[model samples]
Target: MKHRFSRMGVRGRLLLAVLATVAVALIVMTVAFNYLLSVSFRSDADDRLRNLALDESSRISISNGRVTLPQPTGEIQEFGTQIWVFVSGATVSSPNVEPNLQAAAKSLDGQPAQYLDVPEQEVRLYGVPLYYEEERIGTIVSGLWMGSYNYNLRMTLLATGALALVLLLVLGFVGRWVLNAAFRPVSRMTAEAEAWSIADLDRRFEMGEPHDEVTQLASTLDGMLDRLAAGLRRERRFSAEVSHQLRTPLAKIKAEAELALRRERNPAYYQEALASVSQSADQMTRTVEALMAAAQEEGSLARGRASVWQVLEEASASVGVLAGENGVRVRVEPPLRSLYIGVERDIALQIIQPVVENACRFARSTVILGAGRNGKEVVFTVEDDGAGVTEEEKDRIFEPGVRGSAAEAAEAGGATSRGAGLGLSLARRLARAASGDVEVTAGRIGARFVVRLPTG
Candidate 1:
């Protein structure tokens, strides 16, 4: 039974559980009612037979050891309604009386009232001892037949059981139907999910205004699909961007190799060709690494605590040569508490160096790198004295391949577009990967890039 129940689906199990409860209730009620009915029947029979015996005994008289027996009444002549047998030693009231009744009367051992089973029938009876001046003369016993009452009880029980079973069966099916109706939304959700493919993620289970469990589940599934669709889009965009960025260096390398292979070249020519190829190869490698770092939406800097001030010092030192060559003075501010954030030292440098390099390339004089603790976060700022970004371009500064008007103007002046506009974008990505982020805030001077990471 346990295995059978376990094999059934949820609907089947629920239906069977309800039916089983109904069956138990019906059985209990039937048994209790039958017991009460039987008790009532026995009580009625006892009362009737007890009264009849006393009345009939009064009709007979006995004096001086000679008994005067009255003729049995017309009511007593009816066989099953009443029966009487006078007890005097071994003599019964009538010779032709039922032997079962005679036997029952003879063996009366003086109980107030009880049932006695005859050979072919059952009877409820009472024994009354006749008395003359407190001296026992004989015993008069009376009984009523229980065959008709028992027959009626059997018919009643059969009908009651049949009706109960019919009602339970009807209700069980109806309950299953009701449960199916209640779970219709879930059924629709399953069907929709089965029909969907990865390309169809935009289609949502738009169950209107979630007011119930089924609708709420549909809403949750829709939300999950939304996230999945967004992730897929990001992945596709990353691939396209990486391919576009790698093409330039690959073409450069191919052109250099073809020029070198066009004719027999001197050793110096071969050396320059190899050197050109190597530079292009390095450029391609850098481009790949930058794209990869930028595409990493979830950074791996969620562990390892390091001092923010120390990270700032290392980042400034790494880019110190570029700062000097670009004529941009770099300033590093010592934080008040040596605040620590959840990232490694190199990752911290990776996030900071790009923004600082971008700063130095376009800076008029000096770029300031500052760090401090803000609540549970470590906030770092890189502010430059270059031509600051216009309000209209502030939002576009960190977009991939989107150069700010000031950076474009700087490039127009032959100050090289250091790192192809991806540096700041990649900086933000790498910062975000560490459970941190960089944003362009309004700066009175040049663009102010603020980086915030969670304090460990």
Candidate 2:
């Protein structure tokens, strides 16, 4: 039974529940109506019988403890009531009393004043003892035929049952209609959401501010779709960035391998070729790891704490060779107070190294790295005393494959920029992956880049 109920559709189940509730209420009402009707009929019969007995007794007179019967004034009938009198071995009754009814009335002799049912004769009898000066006298019994009352009660019961059944049927139909009307929008929304999920993730319900359950549901589904669309965009961007960044190293490795295999060479020459291939392979590996790490969503990234100073020092040291080769001085300034960031040491270092490398590559004399706290974030500032980034290129330089005008000019003049224009993009991606950001800001005399991470 439980499984069968569970197998029903929601609409069917709701309809059944409503019908069951109405059925129970109808049953209670029908039973109560019939009971009250029966009581009303019985109460009328009892009142008639009682009134008849009392009136007949009042007309009688007693003399010296002997009962005196009153003359029959009229056809002593009211609501088909009958009366019987017994005194000193004599019996007197209303006109046309049947033998069975007389016998049924006699059975009430010497009994207290109360009502009794004589089902065989369809009569209800009530007995009252006549009294004079507290002396024993006689008894009066009144009976009322129950046939009409029983018939009316039966008719009322039938009518009530038929009406209740009709009401239940009507309510069942109305309840089904109401449930369908209520669930119609839900069904349509579910189907549309399923279709949109498969074919058009960008589609949204776009319902206005929520004022009801259905509208609230639409709002929630819209939010979910937005997140799914965002994740898909991120995946596509990650793929494109990886391919663009890894292509050069992969081609270099392939060229070296092909050249080394073309001819037999001295050990040193072959060793040099293998070493170049190895270096390219290493570069490819780093490129892949950095892209993979940056591609992760912040919620899925492994969380750890890293000292702000430690990560800054490590990022600066990693680009020491580039700074020395470029004749640039790299300086790390300690924070006013020790601070921590919410990302792991390695990931934090990865996030800052690219910006530092960019600074070292473009600096003329000095590159400064410093850390400070801002609200609930740890901010690192990297400044380089070189041709400052133009306002137009500051944001554009972070796009993959976009090079600043200075870097482009230096490359055209045969001066190495030592970058393929992916460093800043990777830096920004990794920082965002850790729930942080990297952005360029206006500097007093050079280019300034700000990296912000949540404080640990």
Query: Which candidate leads in TM-score?
Result: 2
Residue range with the least summed lDDT across 10 consecutive positions in model 2: 70-79
TM-score, per-candidate, Cα-based:
0.61, 0.65
Candidate 1 lDDT, 124-217, residue by residue in tens? 5567776777876566677677877898789889988998999898998899899899888788888988998988858888999889988888
What is residue 324's positional error in candidate 1, in angstroms? 29
Q: RMSD to native for every prediction?
A: 8.8, 8.4
Candidate 2 C-alpha lDDT tens digits along 112-195: 787888787677889888776786566788877788888888898899889989998998888888888888878888887667
